[model samples]
Target: MKFNYLVFFALCGFLNLSAQEYYFPKANADWEQKSPKTFKIKDAPLQEAVAFAEANEYSGSRDLRIAIVKGFEREPFHQILGRTKKRGGPAGMIIKNGYIVAQWGDTKRVDMTFSVTKSFLSTMAGLAEDEGKIADTKDLVIDYIWDGTFDGAHNSKITWEHLLQQNSAWSGELWGGKDWADRPPSDGDIDDWKLAQPKEPGTVMEYNDVRVNVLAYSLTHVWRKPMPLVLKEKVMDKIGASTTWRWFGYDNAWTEIDGLQMKSVTGGGHSGAGMFISAEDMARFGLLFLNNGKWKNEQLISEKWIKKATTPSTPNANYGYMWWLNQKGDRHWEGLSENIYYAAGFGGNFIVIDKEHDLVVVTRWLEPSKVGEFMTKVNAAF
Candidate 1:
């Protein structure tokens, strides 16, 4: 009787493992796809959700310049003098077990993915830590970036953890903008812009682009190479991502790195230069996280790093290390898993991953406010 039970249990385990097997496509325009029915996903509701995403227009101004002028957008200080364009229409893919279950629009067209680049930056930081370049996440930033960036009493107290949690509030001018000017309070004054009484690091969770760029510049100091190149060679190529994707910095972000001039990349396209990537490529990135940073036999990113990256910040439970946590009450839709986290960008770009369901969903040019509704419809089908 014991032998029979053991055999039955082994068979069940094998079946479960077989179901989790994934198919990663080769690097090219040709990639295989699967229907929703293949995974027992209800076809009609999924179709309805896609149709909804297709029809609904983005809530922000079509011309991003208008959005910026009207205070509806929080882009970099340089966007006014930089390149800006009307965003493309809705495009996305829903992947189940690494197979494309549903896709719409031109998945290959590379488009600007605003703050989604933050998550990519977060990944780069993880890679730095894994490579032993940055020994500890809790260490003082001034230890590596010895420049006067974190010199003051309050700034000197800042650590990598504080920056990751958006609580650093590190004060300084970066790329020509004061720390407070990036996303200043509506009633901010000159004193506010100067950060005369900057909040103590780790006690405030302010989403300031200048401070984020400070983190980016610090990463440049640690890697001693252009961030885009490091990311391309280490992460993108490993996952078979297309070469068309580009990560950019501002026009004037060049700096001398060991006698070679290198541009310090931004974490997001706040001032018009961030990660411009295809939906398919972004889907591949999301799949990496969905698989806990593994790609087939190779571990592209450490599972430990991914866990810390997704862990909620103490000050902001709905926010992780640049990745947005799905811990919000509105994020709880039927069939949604507990550990879902996502990379969200401006203009309604989102790369949501459900590790529990082994799913990845990428959306571009979607209505920002309707994301919850759209995902809820998709979850209802599950």
Candidate 2:
């Protein structure tokens, strides 16, 4: 009887592991869809959330080129420097246990996902750390690039962690985009920002595109290949994303690495180019994160990296490594789990992961302010 009990316990352990397994979609196969009733989710609240998202479509022009210009008119000399696309209408998907429980609009339509690209950029850093290409996030940037980009005393103090957390305070210009000029303080003029002393590294969180591009450029040098190719080979292709997705950089964002010229992709669509991808692909990426960087049997990104990437940074409790945290900060979403984290972009594109419910919510082109309420409704459904 004692031997029988031991065998029963071992079988139970195997069953528990199997229960936690996620369903991974095939590369070209149809994504399996599950009904909301399967999870005992309330139809009214679920439909309400979907309605809110659909009704609150982003106010930006379909011609994103005009919207881009109007959005950042305060910035000096900001223009469409790279590629921009006419955006599609409201689109989204809600994945429960790696299966689509609800989706709206065209999940297959490709659209620009502005700073959501930052999350992807940070993923490259995570990948580099996993492959030992980056020795440590705490290591200084000069140790890798050795370029004049990190030359100044302020920039010299910058580290990989600083950049990842957006607290680098690295003053510089890259691809003709000035750090200060990218998003200057509204209180003061151009000269004030130009001469303003940079904050100490790892002390202040400032959202600047040039600094983000610096990260992309530095990662390019470290990987010894274009970041887009690296992401495709290591991540997207493995996750079965469609070929329609494209990562773009400024026309001037090219660099010669090992006798080969490659474009250093932007971290956002601020000046036009970043990630142009489908909502379906975005959901897949979110599913990977929701599963803690694992895809079926393959651990594509280390679990350690995903944890670090999602953890709140010291300078900004509401921000992680290029990802947004739902902690009680300025950007906290009320009536939702504080543990939630998401990738947000300029025009209300979001890939929210609620681990507590095993939910991956991908919404694009919804009005930014309505997200909290929409999420509140989603949370109520379960």
Candidate 3:
């Protein structure tokens, strides 16, 4: 018995020693900055990368007000943060081996990150599974959520795995928006969308905010608290993130939980009100994953959960649990690892993780088409 305990302690000791290798950045925007030369990264390509990024920043609407009306061909969702707080500009940083190799723009500005918020929502689901709030991803979601949201026959077949992989095809109206109305085809009308038949759950992958919201709502129910609070206490605070970051949902998203009313946050800012955070804060979140969910001797989220989170869904090889993966090597330059995955949002916001290079990259307002070129340049530097 003593020897058995000794083995357990020995393994724990090894894990603790390995955890110290990750460098968690400082808060208050005091994160250390290092030059490419310091890391033996080439000077020319690094400069070219920065210049390329600066010259080809996202030209889309920096304001959600204009972006929604002009880009989506729809109005804002029922509830959202006021339009005044939205600030859009080019900002980013590149971290190699857990240190900042290069950065540009206003990394401190809080802006709308749109669908990048989905990745954070994915993290919340990981937490739920870790805490046993969700026993199995394959278990039907209707089993846990007693509400009528999953009452229909089509919806009843949906499971947490289906939802996380964007293959649930969950049918229901949420916050005055129908599931199909979120992103109909170019020529498809709302009337046509409403009558559209949903594919069998787990058979098709579709990016729908309504279904994403269902995941958020279900998670909020299981947690019995606001998601922002859960994120802060469980993740942001643990990673030494700044206090300024916020997670929000629509205005009418409030519900009674544990005898108290709380707002159910959205996974992305498609309509509005997702995550408003700085680039540094986003990097810390990426670093946590680059280290396989270990944060300084503490396994805040289980490594098993992270593996599932990053693995490509069977139905969608390029997407994993709300995270976009570069499985085909199409989005990145050649010679880079296929293990590269990222959280991408509208306005070209990206949190790219390259495990092979031990790198984390955060970029805001970069031109969508130039991402590969920028990455190619970054790779050249190293």
Candidate 4:
């Protein structure tokens, strides 16, 4: 029995080693064949980077510290151990001047991007406009979604811009309580629910999932196809996203947003969590935007569209078309005249694009934390 137990442990160890050996073959291949190897900061500069990061108020920096302290409890090692405890676990990447500068964590592991997907969806909507698929942002959402449920006076006046800015004025707790992660509206009583419009569009900034859902529904109506299919064909395939990664709608169907039951036009569907991709793939997306929608001379998204999406157009002055505008200032309020914009997810996931610095930083984590301090530190370094 003792001998058998020893043999079993040895086999398990061997299997784990084998899995680790091939953990990032794709990343290795990309390094060797697809692109140049990622640049690494030297030890002296790295120490300064660590110190700067540690002193920041950013949750990502703290999380990185915690991750190190906890010994990385996850998989895909890439950094150093002991001083940080774990090497690489779940990955993140930074791009500057069209080259990958730093990468940490599992470079190949893909995970849910949550609301950062909104930024991409907004980009698609911009494309839809450029292609003449959708007329303009001011177009009435109800014109596209003529479903009987939207007949209420409030719902009739809602526009695509309103949905994009979360100013649709619809009220209901979509992100709280039992329905926190995956709760859909009642289908049987769908028509019975009434949506209230805000006193005026662009006056208020309310972060609601239902508004995004309405955007999804409206886009589907205009495109005459499912959101995921549109995204896959229009964006993902063009970008050459890895086959191991998949973007899901609400549900499982390729055509369905959240499963086949719900449509993308449902309120808050566009803003809340619905899309999934790998960290590296997300970095590619950030790079695309950093390059003004150009990828190696191929314009996947129009430069005009990119500018409008990132530029602020609402009263809040901190939001653009489904993206967050980062201004210069302290923790109290966003200061004036800053050129940074980012797509922020619920937790600590961020794809920050700094036009002034010509840099893009992408990060992902399981915990819900802010990266402001970390951003400040990184920006200061630059």
Candidate 5:
């Protein structure tokens, strides 16, 4: 039995070594090496903020203090990549009282934000509504999109609200097929890829990427500009996101779709996928939403729009207009709350805002381990 135990321990050590060697990059990449000009928190008293973050118990080894301290000197993106690659854990950021208080891992590194881009798209939809470019969420997509090619019996019933809520009933397979990647669609061929719609819209909460693509298409049809440009001129510019950040789309005009270059997409835009930005800038976005779309005294996104975007319009928990709602309940289950909304991407990219506590947390990483525990610690600190 003792020999068996020894063998087991040896195997475990080997596995750990392999994991470390496999995941971590040998030489630090650009994201892993960039640092923020200012890493200090300006909202609450600094000592108190530090104490609060220190009080929380993260699930990792307590010996992590040395690494955490080393992170202070490292670039935010590198720190996050290091932790994610080494520990296979989530990165974190915390904003309290309108100032960034604490962060862990590669807090500033930008990665694919996955569905979180949906929330941004939803905000744009609201802007369109406010501009009278779109009448309302209930407006049929055909109203905005030209060609009316998608005006089938099933698709005809799809509305802006249906798409926003991820209930457009479109098959995800159409966009996600392996073959589809090889034969990329032409600039104008996006409409030809539309698939058969489901039986009903809004009856089920199906997370469909194609619906988001259609939303982008609809936006382009109305604004006569690419989705990214609209987002840049309206959202990113208004919020003062750093020039370092890039939102991907087709053509430099924002209509081109190179899968690798464009991270944020309409469904999950290219920019959002690998949207690169400093963690501080991501915190700025959180603060902008926390203040109900006001940044530096500028009314960027309207309060009404913010509220509507974060509020869950479907039965799905933690699902708002493309944002994830984080409520206080079972950690495994969904449904955060109206007070806390987040822009979450896959592999654990997050921009979390706690309105009641005046807190925002942003994290970017390559994996999803320990995210729950990290979030728990952050919540406790609040």
Candidate 6:
């Protein structure tokens, strides 16, 4: 009777192991695909979502350098300070229950992801938190780096959480970029913005690339190595992301850490350099998040970190740790779940994660205004 009980338990374990649901695409191999019908998804709505993305291509010129200047024409000294690439046409893939249900255009073409890089940057911080590198999110920046970066009275109160939530209001210049010059208030003149009183740390949310770069700079100092290398060795390589992907920094963005000169990557392509990656890889990243940071059997990032990263900040209900939330705020999608959160970038690049449906959608070069509607259409099929 004891032998029979043991045999029954072993059989149950085998059955549970065989019941794994998610599918992770192998590196350099053909990704497995499935039909929408397999999951009872409405094919017409799914196809319409793809067509809507393709038809609503970003109005910006394929020449991103020109687009960069034209889009941020208001900001003073906004030049292509780093490498910018001519982008490919509309491209995307829809992952439902871990298999590709639909794909459009060139999925493998490497293109600039612009501010979508912030999500990855946030992941670095999450990894740090998981590893105890960042002792606490509330810890003051000056505690980690005694440099004059956090010397000012207002800047002294800035914390890691504030930086991650885009509310740090970090005041200073780094890599030839001034804190106030980035995406300044439209109603103010250059001198007015420069002289404007900085907001209290954690009091307001501002989307400033200069401050984002400061976070990158701090993370670089914390890791004691290049952020890109840390990303590749720790996350990307483990997730089987393609070799075609690259993270870049401004030409002048370099620092000496431990007597070794390491380049600190930017969190966005506002000044031109950031993550240049394919749509498939972006989907893979979204899948990792959908699985709560677990890549297959290994947890690349902790679930605790993900919860903290996705929770809405007091300043911005629609924003998290560099990730945009669909929490019925100004940026919320009309019909989509409030739980949906995504990484958005300039020129309509996105990595949308819908964990409720086990769905991951990556789209590039779609019109920025059409994103909420596109998501609405995509979710309709499910």
What are the lDDT figures for the candidates, one per model? 0.81, 0.92, 0.83, 0.56, 0.54, 0.91
Tens-place lDDT per residue, model 2, 129-179, is: 999999889999998988698997778889999999999988878899888
Q: Write candidate 6's Cα lDDT for 1-382 as tens digits.
A: 2468656876778443322588998988888999899989999999999999999999999999999999999887778889899999999999987899999999999999999999999999999989999988889988997889898788889999999999999988889888888887778578988898999889899999999999999999999999989999998899899999999999988899999999989999998999999999999899889888888999899999999999999999999999999998899898788889999999999999987788899999999999999999999998
lDDT against true structure, model 6: 0.91
TM-score of each: 0.91, 0.96, 0.91, 0.68, 0.64, 0.95
Give candidates' CA RMSD values in order.
2.9, 2.0, 4.2, 17.1, 18.5, 3.1
lDDT of 3: 0.83
TM-score of 5: 0.64
Better of 3 and 4 by TM-score: 3
Among the numbered candidates, top TM-score falls to 2
lDDT tens string, model 1, 1-382?
Answer: 2468656866877444533497776787576899889989999999998999898767777666665455434433534423455667789999989998888888998888889999999888899999899998999998998878889788889988888778997877877866766765666464545546787787768887778878888898899989999899998998889989888887788888899999888877666678889999999999888877878878889989998998888777778889888885544444556588899988889999987777889999897888878888878778
User: lDDT tens digits, residues 1-382, model 3?
Assistant: 2468656876878444334555677666478777778768898998888888888878766666776556667522433433225565788999876788889899888887888999999999999999999998889998999889899879999999999999999998887667876777766566766687999998888889889999999999989989999999999998998888888888788778778988888888877788999898999999999888877667898999988988888887888889888787334445666898999998789999998778899988898888877888888887
TM-score of 6: 0.95
Worst lDDT 10-window in candidate 1: 72-81
Cα lDDT over the full model 5: 0.54
Off by over 4 Å in 2: 2-19
Using lDDT as the yardstick, the better of models 1 and 6 is 6
